[model samples]
Target: MGATINLLVMASMPIAKVLLLAAIGSFLGLDHVNILGEDARHHLNKVVFYVFNPALVTSTLAKTITFESFLTLWFMPVNIFITYLLGSILGWVLIKITKAPRHLKGLIIGACSAGNLGKLPLIIVPAMCREKGSPFGDVDVCQSYGLAYASLSMALGNFYMWLYTYNIIRIFSRDVIDDANHPEVGDESFGNNTEFLLKPTEYSLMTPNNKIPMSSKFQQLLSQFSGKINLKPLFSPSTIGVLVGFMIGLIPPLRKLLIGNDAPLHVIQDSAYMLGDATIPTITLILGANLLLGLKGSQIQFRIVIGIVATRYILLPLLGILIIRGAIRGGILKCDPLFQFILLLQYAVPPAMNISTMTELFGNGQSEYSVILLWTYGLAAVALTLWSTIFLWLVAS
Candidate 1:
């Protein structure tokens, strides 16, 4: 019992820090302040995405992940996929039950499906490792391995969130979304791209049948091939980090150069690590700013919010416990409590904030997404703390 109390405090402190930072972000985003207001927040998001996050991803992966760990944790990608699959099913049910608008169906499903796997765990896991009475033995060992797990989760989450959930939102948003103000629709060659791909080759210019060039055909084939396998996410920085880091950690020469004290180019790795350190705070602040928008006004129903909350916070965690424990019992998962703890944490987080941007990209139900995010995150302060405490107790025992 005493240990549980300590675990709660250990878990809660980092979350409290995140909440505090988020509140500050909200304050900065207020109309009166305008520091992290809409435009500024967008710019900051760009920085985090293209710069800070990638650096963090690469550094963490390179520093902690190894070929053995990668092989052992193979189920992570599958686990992430299950979260999306289950949430999507639940979201679809919600849409049908609530009679939600067709335009908002994808957004609803997306909100249910994608968890904020990156930011919170990055914050939570590291913070938990820092506590006085932590379960994970050896502070440095705990931090390193904990980060490896979190980084993998973040990479997988980012890949899945954009590819699967983003497409779901994009596909459903197309019919009802307004073309006039919809950013992607404004492109002159929007529908023409697909038309060009499928159109038969013209005989000749004189016959007024334009001959499609071989290059064009190949390009279309390439595009179709890429889309079929969802290749875009594979190239995302997080995935790249995983791939490159895996190589470095596995290969002797590269690993020696970037890791440990005596390496010649350790400075470069250190530089990246320093830059990567900025990721958590930046992500939290953006989360706060986005939540501010959600709080101000939303047409979303309370029941919808409750449904997502219930799905993410309660239902998914139960599923994780079963799946993970079963995997362990069946000898598929290692019994490392920290690794187990990280896997459990993956299931219990809020919806990915990137889903909000996705709705905006499709020009559908961005406001509704904001409202959903607000409630989930607001409740996560309590949900994450309690769940983390219970999870630690279970894993440690």
Candidate 2:
């Protein structure tokens, strides 16, 4: 009971610290719009993506990972997959029941499945790890493990984004094409690209009939070939950073150069570690700013807010506890306190803020996403507080 109470107290500390810092920043107007400037935000994101994040991942994974540890961490993937699947299904069912537009269904599910990985794990997991007494038995290991998780989560998020975006585009485009090809369709103007081409447009318009001219076919082919190749994904700074870091971690010769007491690259690694340390606080502050700027009480629909909040905070956590308990009873997984806590932390996490950002990017239902985000966070804060208190009491008793 004492151990449980200690665990609960430790778990609550990080979340409280993050929220407090964010709230203070928001209240002080330090995080107000235009305070940091868009260019600064972009540059900071780039720095995090390309330098700090990868460095942190490489450093942590190299230090902590081995064949045995690798086997244990397998649970991370399973937990992520299950949560995503469950969230997606729930979102889809809700959309269907609401009879929302077909186009919105995908967006809704994607938003629900996407989580605030950056802030949640960085802030919450490390504390949880420390509480559970990781193999390293050092608080710093929490930060290191958090970084590794962050890298994996980021990679997964990017992959999901690409898949989801492609599906959305294909669905919408197929629908448009089908509408155009229907003989009974009275709207001749619906798919008329020639008319659109004749008129100057703000956005680039593409139509199925706009084939390349025969004379310019080779030139057009080359142009299309060049345009079709998006090297950005492959060669982007972030990709390069992650690749380099991953390689270094996997290769003992390179790994030796980056870490350890006698390492030549220790200084570089240390600097990166320091910078990586800043990521969590910055993310939390940004989240607070976003909430302060956009999430007004009046904008929320209480019933919808309650439903979404309950799904994340109540249903998910309870389900996760049950799953963990069942896994233990069945001997599917060894009963490790750390693993149990991790599963709990995953369930306790709030909705990903990135979802709302993505919804706005796709020009979908931003308002609904915003409401969902606001409620998710709000509910998570409350639920985590209550859960932590209860968990602490149970452990201490």
RMSD after Cα superposition, model 1: 6.0
Whole-model lDDT, candidate 2?
A: 0.57
Per-residue error at 269 for model 2, in Å? 2.1
Give the alpha carbon lDDT tens digit for every residue of 41-150 in model 2: 54655666666666555555655554465676666657767767776777667665665555455555665555554457667667555655333245675556555665
Candidate 2 collision pairs: 1-395, 1-396, 2-395, 4-395, 5-395, 115-352, 116-352
Model 2 alpha-carbon miss at residue 393, Å: 8.7
Clashes found in each candidate (C-alpha, N, C closer than 3 A)? 0, 7
Each model's lDDT comes to 0.81, 0.57
Q: Which candidate wins on lDDT?
A: 1
lDDT of 1 by residue, 1-397 (tens): 7777788898899889999999999888888998998899999999888777878877888887777777888888888888889888888888778877666777888888899898899989988888898999999999888877887788889888878887777655653443445555443323444543353542231224655577765676676545444436447777777787777778889999989879999998899888888998998888888898786667877788888899999988888889988989999988899988988888899999888777777677878888888889999999999889888888888
- CA displacement after TM-score superposition, residue 241 of candidate 2 (Å): 5.4
Least well predicted 10-residue stretch by lDDT in candidate 1: 199-208
